[model samples]
Target: MDTPLINALEALKKENRISFHTPGHKKGRAYESMDDGGIQENLYQYDTTEVFGTDQLQDPTGAIKESQQWTARVFQSPEAYYLVNGSSAGVLAMILSQTKPGDEILLPRDVHQSVIHALILGDLTPRFIQPEIDPQFKIPKGITLPQVQEGLEKYPKCKGVLLTHPNYYGRPGEIREIRRMTREFGKILWVDQAHGAHLGLHPQLPLSGIDAGADLTVTSFHKTLPAMTQSAVLFAGGEVVDRERLLEQLNMHQSSSPSYILLASIEQGTRHYAKAGKEKMQVLLEAIESFEQKFRRLGLFQLDTAPGKDRTKIWIHTENSGRTGHEVETYLRENHGIDMEFSMPQGLLALTSIGNREKDLKKLYLAFEELEETLYNKVKMEKFSEKYSKEAKEGFFEKEVERDKKEPLGLPIRTAFYSRKERVSINKSVNRVAGSAVTPYPPGIPLILPGEAITRGHRDQLLEYEKRNIKVIGIKAGKIMVVAEE
Candidate 1:
């Protein structure tokens, strides 16, 4: 069979690489401990639609309703809805349901691109809140209490606030304080907790959005939990949530025929979390600590101990090692057969979960040692300056071109997105309205949003990212789409 994707996947599977990434089952190893009735082995047979015994996802009444109710209880939400389209659909649904067309919503600048898409879909205006950036990581850390207060105060008419808890490297902000402030303002607080499904399972971990008093929350079961990809759950709590409207939005965004395989995995994952997830998380945490200790003793490859850091996310700094994180990631893959979640210029993030074994940590540690030795022999640590070459470092501007100072009343996202646009060279696009969002995946935060005027800073940063081989979503060739003048 001429199945390149399948063949490649099979070949990758044959190599038996240790996973520190997601769909958190770690290639279905977590399923081995489950007492599932051969469902893991025969998942294909259960892939049927809304027939006799099977229930509809759109308007759940039978088994699906019971399953959702159980999950809601497990997560301590007043209501829970299963989503097979992943957290993106849940995010869109949350936005559309909460705000009317042209209504404004308060959100962080570092929100996932899906939130921007929701703005386009709902014709909603975004009141952007600026999160404090990690000086070392060059990524937005998380929204602070003052930032949320200022955002809400500045955009008093905005329907509510939206935030991503434990921003991608798994560091949580002051969510409880932010939640209290949102409540005092008599506004809704919606949380995009896509990377935090395993939170609240352990006391050491940060509280889940539902637990932190968010009016609405969406979590991906597949990210840090043992579930099939594309499975997520939308949680609704507090008096502010419009349950009926939220359900309608879910129906609109989700597929008519949801995958039974995904639904089954969500259910199984819920059971696993309730039954065995806690103990396994404890073990994973201990393993992570031990792994960090090895590097700590050697005084190499420092682990990120950012305040309120989720120890599960191992952010190993390679800045002093004379190799870029991207370079280290490739070396690990080629030499050690170890997979990482993502990499920035400074470091690689290993998204450890309950699925990861102690042996996997040991393998990663050994790989790190080898990488350090290789780098030490080839290049002097002092000689390798600027993180990524000097030019690249200068190009990777930390600020967002005074985005925080800009008013939220730029051209509406939908208007600019649907407007007639023409492709122009990246250099020529400066000062023109962006026709689409230019985002970098892995983190998936937009650098240039639809309706925003492209700045010289945006152009320069994007060109540098391209030169360094970073994937920019909206660029094709060396041009970008800009709103055409009449």
Candidate 2:
């Protein structure tokens, strides 16, 4: 793996350059990482300031440019840029660069919290394409072409659509059809492919966003690939996205001093994918197949292999097996020393990649086998959801839906974000115009957004989530910020 970024860092460090750099570390001499048991010496050496050979990340001219070009080539993207600040930065950058405040951007309701933040920063009006919620898994499936068509038709002034190729639950969407429609309608297509970074690597994978002709596709390489956390890549697929403006937006969000270690990891991951992605993915697929066959016979767990879903992620539903997603997660962690990707209310998502070890998976199977016996011998148990919310006959999410039916947008999102607001208790927050997003952080989905009229039901749901220890952002010190009364 030829990492130009790492090579530059190593060569610069080997030369033993003197002081007089923006970074106060001065080549990790004064940094306590060397003395104390902090970051390794190699990281300190590699973590250099943007000196002569070390190219600037904002305006990549040398190694960064070369590395990104290789990345583009490997991914078959027209143009690509490194994102050190994760896909969150990429999502924000795309929205900021392409759409202006008050512009309408149609998207699915189940988007990441970062998208909500981006909507706020851009002050863009969001027209949500109602996602088909999976009855079995309770997760929102990706938007279809018909939904996109309806959104566009409903919101005539909508500039573009931001589609999440694969929802966090490993459900993929109709990217190719959506792309074709976006082109036909002369609308920009931004695919938030935070989970599809390794899509093109294997033939078994679903359609890659760039190949599907998305205007702008941003991927968090760390999510599914062997890249370091916070490592991501942004692509300018079509003429819709202005490359220079995208770069400018990236610079606005990205750190002035980017991490060489993360940049090098991105390069290395790309190189690895180019070399052995197919073979590795095949092995992973085979292993998963074997695992599934064995698990299916056990008659305990259920898998979500719905159409258009990613094969790399194993979505295990333990409802029939008498286990909650969190219980399964805890068992897998404490009993088997295996931490799953995420545990939703319906099921647990186990992330398997080309990099996953066979022995580790085998161990996971053994753990499941143990879990079956343990659960089998045990008496009847109450469901986690059932244990909570004695008052609400419907499930927690159903209550949320009932709340959402209360009212519509109070004002434009742009106006609401910029308006003078006051903090109020959850009880008093009803009928007040929301000044910010109230989101569930784990899934990173916002329940309510700025300018939306907060209802009593919405407040109750927020309180329930808080009581359950689930993080609800935008509520500070038992108060929610909302637009003040004139």
Candidate 3:
């Protein structure tokens, strides 16, 4: 009998679209481009389960152990563990290992949704550090050193500070200064280095979290490195993380029957980086620079050139082209057959890596050039209203006012989460404790987190959501969730 899964795989192979998306190796060229035929064949052969030669992932004392050691050496970390689960697991493990319930942690507002989930699961109190916002681009920038200093001062008893380095948009923060601030405050600096797996390979690239004095850092190998999906690494610095506790936490979160394919892919990807990552990345950077020039000439989309941003992760704002990022993304996928990483309301992101070929990028440049010629003259660019953008910015800060209050919503998150919550009208929910997190997904910082009392400003933001027809979760048809009690 023909299986549907096999049929889907065959269909995917038939499409043969250029992937400007993930797994780093766009078209399996890294493996196919190998000089040694025997090595390439062996690579494919060992991509199997825990068979005769291949050992189990959890109790790795053979090839997997060796691979982990090599990875640690390459990244210059004291110890590293292969994360069969993505860096999300590693982030949760690290946080759970260190702190207990009621322990306060300072988190950057721009942190990934996974971190927020960890906070909820661990029942940890979170004090947010607002990252600088680039109003012109409508993108949040990195956490400033002063912000870290201020957070530590404000929450002197807080257990740790969690940061997302080289944020999703690829903006790198001043790690050295932030490290100094954390050290002075005697707080463990846990870094979410998910988007920076390849940083250690090239010195010219942004500094790796480990080098910047992070206590524990997690890297998603599949993001910028040539690893299989869900393969990541958790790195620990000297005398910072408790090894025994970390191992126990890993066991708690990680799978018992971890995928051998993902574990082995970590080894192969690390080896590839150690051998030729810098050289390959240099070549890729050069190609990207040339492509940016070509796109500028076409005037299709304007690239975001914020200082210290990752050159490889190209972000292009298409609002000026009379199209939303979603429209451009749909056009590229359906018409041009080009797949991208993500498309925000404001812009589209095309992620490049060492594994991308010259031919692949040429296709992207050519496609954009043709698209520009066809649409630029016909479509009049709509100037995005500064008023709407300003209101959104003001709304974000207004949410923070409730978050910072001394008796802010005075209820435990878990208690509120699983409690007999009732749906109340947005206006009626004013001054009532929130039973959920309601915020924009791209930034993902909650405007109304569990236990935070809703205010008029909160009501205003929610009303704006209704005006724009944006879906608000944990609410019944525009009604907000509040504690069922009086």
Candidate 4:
């Protein structure tokens, strides 16, 4: 297929004086990678501006528009927009475009921070529907039907229902049921499917948000598909979404000087997936299942529930072997030179995407075999013996949201996000209203949000996370940010 966007960039490179445009890099002169020879040259050479022939992102008609059309067809959406800045931009644009200021929206509490940002920026009120927590993994699974129905009932003025399908752990929910309910209530559905870019491309994967009839869906192609980091696509499906407003917001959220390199990545990646995704996914699933069999036969590792999951994600419970997820993460990196996606207190996430080679799976099996031995010995030395933790066998995840009793939800997120704030000791911050979100970086879910009263539970969680070397954003040096007292 003709990669129009990439061809345009290559043609510009042939022009030789493309530097006369804008990007001060001047095509690999000052800013080449450490490699300095291969794709680095082309990468900088094609870094371009909205010159005469190159179509503008805000108003596309040429190569850029053509690339988007190809992407839409492949993703099974009526309309698609390339996002240079990642799914965050799409998320903010979708919310602000669909809902009026002060309009209520039903959402899961486990939503990405970008959703919280949209709530603040768009002045949209949120009625949080807590997602069902997996007791064994402690990670939030899919949102339950009762939770969504209750939120919509409590907030009768809700204009839209926003959700995350195939959550961080690859748990696929009843997206079809949610779609049916939203349609019955005359509410638009917006999905933040950042991690489900490969959905609908393969039969084994879950139904995509577009397939589930979402009005607007945002996907980060970088998450699962063969794409560069920060590349994403915004899918518009149902007629409920206003294309004009979506486009306007897309233009507003993104920068004028969008990266040609990123745009070409989306185009090139989409082209490849459209042709070969099904074959690739089939092979990947086979390799993953083989590895799972190898691990299960040994009976050394505790595997997560697989009844409803994307299958590409590999989550192993380390608690059984008397190891924290952080410890396992460190072991994988330091011992095997393999960096994993994310690790929680009880489980570690290993992602298998189109980037993996069959040999990579082979190596992964070997590495985990070695890891299993180390964990067994550690448990033995600690007097836990050859037996695994019984709780781990069944799973040990947090089942529900344990709200802080003292610090109740105080103000709207928008008001508290903009309020004057001060940083205080983590202990002293208790009972004060939060001025900013304090979220764990990997999951990006707010443990404490702006306008929520900080309680003892919040303080303890942050402090424990601090000890574990986990990143807590919106805090300064060891202190938490809180609304300053007048």
What local distance difference test score does each model get? 0.83, 0.77, 0.76, 0.76
Estimate, for each residue in 1-486, the C-alpha lDDT of model 2 and write its tens digit: 699999998977766533221122234332221231223446777778799998999898999899899989888888898999999999999888998888999998778878888887887888877788777666677888899999988888899999988877778889999989988888999999988887887676789898898989999887777666788999888887877789899999999989988887677668767776677778878888788877876667788878667877788877665455666786676556676766654568777766675665788788788777766766333323345323333455456445434356898876898899889998899889999888766666778888889988888877876665666788887788899889
TM-score of each: 0.94, 0.85, 0.84, 0.87
Summarize candidate 1's per-residue lDDT along 184-214 as a digit string, tens digits: 9988898999999889788888888999989
Clashes of each: 0, 0, 0, 5
Candidates 1 and 2, the one with greater TM-score: 1
Number of the top TM-score candidate: 1
**Residue 395's C-alpha lDDT in candidate 1?**
43
Instruction: Quickly count the clashes in candidate 4.
Output: 5
The TM-score ranking, best first, is: 1, 4, 2, 3
What shift in Å separates residue 197 of candidate 2 from its native position after superposition?
0.5
Error of 1 at 59 (Å): 0.6
Stretches of candidate 2 exceeding 4 Å from the true structure:
1-41, 298-300, 321-323, 379-407
The collision pairs in model 3 are none
Candidate 3 Cα lDDT to native: 0.76
**Model 3 residue 228 distance off true place after TM-score fit, in angstroms:** 0.8
